[model samples]
Target chain A: MRQHLKKAGIILFWLLVWQLVSLLVHNSVMLVGPVETIKCLCRLVVTADFWLSIWYTFWRIGLGFLCASLLGILLAFAGAKKLILGEFLSPFFAALKSVPVASFVVLLLIWFGSKNLSFFTSLIVVLPILYGSTREGLANNDKKLLEMAQVFRIPFGAKLHYILLPGLSPFWKSAFSLALGMCWKAGVAAEVIGQPLQSIGNRLYQAKIYLETGDLLAWTVVIILLSFGVEKAFARLLRLLPGEEKKEPDSMKEKGDVA
Target chain B: MTIQVDHVSKFFDGQPVLDNFCMELSDGNSYLLTGPSGSGKTTLLRILLGLTRPDSGRVRLLGDYKYSAVHAGVVFQEDRLCEPFSAVENVAMVSKKLSPRIAREALEKLLPADALDKPVRELSGGMRRRVAIVRALCVPSDVLLFDEPFTGLDRENRKKAIDLILAEKGSVPLLITGHSDEDLGFCHPIDIRTGVPLQMG
Candidate 1:
């Protein structure tokens, strides 16, 4: 198709520009071309150590993301149900939102060491995002649905399944999209600082130390690919959930029931 | 089941909505609540449905069982259906006794068969209202409430909806709030403003 060819042409043009820039620099340490970066990636992919590092980093960051999501959901429900709990947690959330990631990274590195440094870092980075979105979602639940449930005497289980889940799904999607990217960035930064034994961050650090700009670019590309891939996969899984396919029409909504 | 609203008083922003309201609702009879807007008709219904608390007096359900145990089905003024769910899912989600087949059959009387599987959000307002009506009727409850349930329905569909309600409802009390006196056959009209029952021809 013309569109595909156009996309290919655009990509090739960018690659050509990068190759020219690298030739003009004439210093491999200063700039790595796309070809060298791809070659470095090809060499890295066949190694056992590379796969081990990928797995280690993947699971640590993934576990942090999972933990943050669960906690965020629980806290959201608790805050929505009890006003006092929401008030009590306001300062904590504010502090979490305002505190610098680098400060936490340094402190966490000293306290917990490098083994779980990335885990805690990712959790901290993602928690407030998911929590805030979840709380907003719960707060914005349709009051009409609540009244209907009350009058119909719909059971708690049915209300949760039919109303709450569908209502909160948009918030979940947005939260997950943002949290995924944040988790990967903060997680890799943590690993770079903490220098975990078998991690992509450690590889990136070593590449920088050895002046292997191609390896550094390849590792950076890998992070971007993994982050985007995970986000897409998670969004797909969310779409597969029951009742998630029903999207609100932008314009033709019934006058009174838009809420 | 008998619903007794005894000297119930409710105030919003220091203004009385339901002042010394009293009423008796008996089973096997449908009550048509006719009142002007802001006459506390909805407030009375909310109190009866246990959604609001009265500042004074109490609403008692005098029967063999406790008032809290009795379930009341409601067709809200707005079709308060789960937007993403199909008509069958919306009906069956609240029903403990009626199967999906029975709910589908009940909905088929008021809606086209092809519209049954579509999400309630995609359906027109009339169709959604019918879905709400079917949802209320199909559920296992001791009483039924309809708050302007016929707002967007055509005359023919309104009649069909009424027939569906009558067909599905048993001896349980059905209380409906309507602005017009037309099409209120066999229903005891009660004026919430005067606290007096109006005689109907």
Candidate 2:
């Protein structure tokens, strides 16, 4: 409870600072305080268009992330098994990581239309991260455990359940955390450029053109909340995967044990 | 089946770990392989399991073997139980022939009932060792290989583990490595360095 209060107090301090800065500027066009941004958000929430815009971008980007994750894991498994495939794809994934998100967004807009820009953009952005993390995870799997499995002739399904998933959990968790945030940023940027109809990015673009600082800040706040919410939800989903849960040692409870 | 270690030699970094070691491990017998540290006890076990290949020698499974490959239940020097899994899951995961119920029964013979449900990581060292022993016994294999399986085990638990292994490893060749032959005198004692049976004085 104290920790939560401390966090709220910190946020309130920053809001006070933001309000003072906006009052000094005295131009609502250039700067809007937290109060104005919240008021704008309240007004936007009542409109049907606001919910529709959220749904449009949410499904597209969410689908892109899910598909990329599946593909990345499958490809990483194949890559790990075949050295030649890993060697072959190393440069391709590296290039994908290096290329700027804007360049891909522009090129995607030309090849495809604005309709599926966020989907493709987010997919491309998240694929390499997932692939790299999974590859590293596979590489770091305990060799001794694998050898034990091999000697015992444990089936592939059992090995995957007992060894592979648990080994990959840590890497996947960190990678998902990173890729979730990256996908949202890239997906929204693509939407803004493509000006997709009935999308959050389209609203953000309109807000910019009309110089509605309050609407812009409000939409930005919405994106932040959405990104945070999705990340938390995805993390909770990841916990369902089979692995070890870390717990504090209860010395008193551990006594009188026999083996 | 008899596992013949025919002059098996393994070297690391141009140094001889096992120089022309030879031994015959026949079926329905247990061996206590005694040696000091760095005496290639583990190397010999690895060679039998085909995890490591000898530099110049070969291992042969003589007699009628149902399978082309050697299937072994091994307890490694380290307690290689999946740390996140409970003792029952660890044992059950080794073979489809063994289920969670079967594993729980086997583990109950050596471990406390309360410890069976907890993750192996949370268990004490001796408890983890016992879990490894149970996992090895639960797996279906033609041979049983244990390297330092008694580490961290007290005399009472050690006796329980030994009894469980002997009961479970029926008609299979069992090779266990340890620091001494005390309390393991029932098995034929062999010094790994000499690769021959020790003189029982």
lDDT of each: 0.86, 0.90
Interface RMSD, in order shown: 1.3, 1.1
Q: Give the number of the best model, judged by lDDT.
A: 2
Q: Model 2: iRMSD?
A: 1.1
User: In model 1, what is the error at residue A118, expressed in angstroms?
Assistant: 1.6
Model 1's DockQ score: 0.69
Scored by Cα lDDT, where does model 2 land? 0.90
Candidate topping TM-score? 2
Tens-place lDDT per residue, model 1, B58-172, is: 8778787565745888887678788888999999988667688988888888899999998888999888988988888877788898899898988888888888788778999
Question: How much is A195 displaced in model 2, in angstroms?
Answer: 1.0
**Candidate 1 local accuracy as lDDT?**
0.86
**Candidate 1 CAPRI assessment class:** medium
TM-score of 1: 0.91
